[model samples]
Target: MKILVVDDDPNILELVSIQLNQAGYTVQKATNGFQAMELLEEELPDLAIVDVMMPGMDGYTLTRKIRAYADIPVLLLTAKGELEDKEKGFLAGSDDYVVKPFEPKELLYRINAILRRYDKAVDVFIQAGPLKINRQSYEVSVGKKVLLLPLKEFELLSVLASKVNTVFTRDMLIERIWGYDYEGDEQTLNVHIKRVRGKLENLTGEVTIATVRGVGYKLEVASI
Candidate 1:
């Protein structure tokens, strides 16, 4: 998971970045809310940690702006520990609040808790026959066995599994999996489909990928 850390203090930014990095998370740093918003526009992070005392674009304002469009969770990290400050942070759409001088373990714990809540709220799993695809972890499982595929292959299977027995056109798949800016041709989609098919075959025969001649592909389940 990626986390954005925004603080005017260089020391706090470095400290928070180190803590998040050591906890197996990718960290993006920003000295102020403007820089953070720029980074957000480039690529949204899973969560954001913002300090409330920045010169311009305070934490509360940034949290409100982020909440207006993105669903990314925000955690206010600041020196203000008063009750009113906590209430204001919550009102600004922050998922949690952490005061300064906090223990590293506590910060990590809160981050994990917020992420867990978000995952449970939005993560969707696709189940086709005996196969289960976990969107969050990108793990495909059948029975008690686990199968991992390359990113593209897994995404292909995921798209097909989303609507079993429904054929998706080659162009649709390409546009959905590879963005519209993709410069590749139909050959790329075919290659990914072939790889996904090979991997699915190793699992139970309950699910299969079917190619619709002159069109695209679909996921077929024996029970359906």
Candidate 2:
């Protein structure tokens, strides 16, 4: 997942960035709301962490602006712990709020909760012929046989199965699975695809991953 952290205090920003990065999320930092807006124009983050107090555009204004454009979740970070402050944060469009003296583990838990809620709001289960994929549980099964797959392999299969026969380019797969900041090359994606194909082969011709020469790959299901 990708997260954008906006704060005028460099120390807090760095601290949050480090913690999030260590937790396996792609983190982007902005010193203030203006910089956050600029970054938003370039790319939309999966979630945003905005401090309630800033120089030019305050966190509330920033949250409102963000809601106007995207449906991504926003988490407000500030020292205000009063009921009215939290109410205002929610009114301004924040999905969650955390006080400055908040525990790091609590902040992480809130982030995960927001993400889980969003994922559940959308359909988490995908079905393609005899193949079934459960995104929330990270489970893949063909008929009665449960397939064990590595994390990357499971994600790759999920993406392809989500859209049946729709061809997904290598770039699309990498961007969706590895994020925009993925440092790996096409060869890396190829390796994961190969591994997924190996596992799918155990399904006895029920599913197949078809490569489209110079294009990309698509999930093909044999007619029962």
Candidate 3:
């Protein structure tokens, strides 16, 4: 597997490359997000490990930009270990996140987990009653028509729809969707949820993405 590792720090770039190479994967290095973008244009890597802090473009912007075209799995690296940072990464588009000073084995394990998750079947179109979610296609439809959605909206809905009625704490949502280093933007999650709810209002009357008061949100499956 060809893995692209993006980090501004030379030590991290060298160390991560060495570790991935030792693990028997081909490694590519990018010192910043722009360099990573250039590499991406030339080679579509199997996986990407990106740092949150960079010179030209930050990890979140890079993730968002790349996610526009490809859904190739992404693992984020950040020194800022906060729920908000984790949420930001998820909102920007990331598969997983890890903190700085992390164990190489742990990072390897997270990569394995991400790859395994991809191996499992996740139907893009999850239809139940009036709602349908296209996980791979990133489209959502209700009743007879399909609605356009932004990347964050689609990703947030995808996470919620995967398991109905399961309440996700803000932190879990951040970790599962945004990645670990994600910064605060519950408001980001809130806005997208509100937008998704508005789109589904005709079918369900109210929001299918349920807010748990002070906690987080859940996907309320409508019974037919």
Worst ten in a row by lDDT for model 3:
115-124
Which TM-score value belongs to model 2? 0.62
- Poorest lDDT segment (10 consecutive residues) of candidate 2: 114-123
Better of 2 and 3 by lDDT: 2
Best candidate according to TM-score = 2
Task: Give me the displacement of residue 186 in model 2, in angstroms.
Answer: 31
Q: How does each model score on TM-score?
A: 0.60, 0.62, 0.54
- Ranking of all candidate structures by their lDDT, best first: 1, 2, 3
RMSD of 3: 13.6
Candidate 1 ranges beyond 4 A from true positions: 126-131, 134-224
Candidate 3 per-residue lDDT over residues 90-144, each given as its tens digit: 9998999999999987887687568547633545467655677777676677766
lDDT of 2 by residue, 125-218 (tens): 9898899988878888877888878888887888788667777667557766776566878999999998888888876578899998887899
Kindly give the number of clashing pairs for every candidate: 0, 0, 11
| Candidate with the larger TM-score of 1 and 3 | 1
Residues 130-160, model 1: lDDT tens digits: 8899988989999898998888888788878
Q: lDDT value for candidate 3?
A: 0.78
Off by over 4 Å in 2: 123-201, 204-224
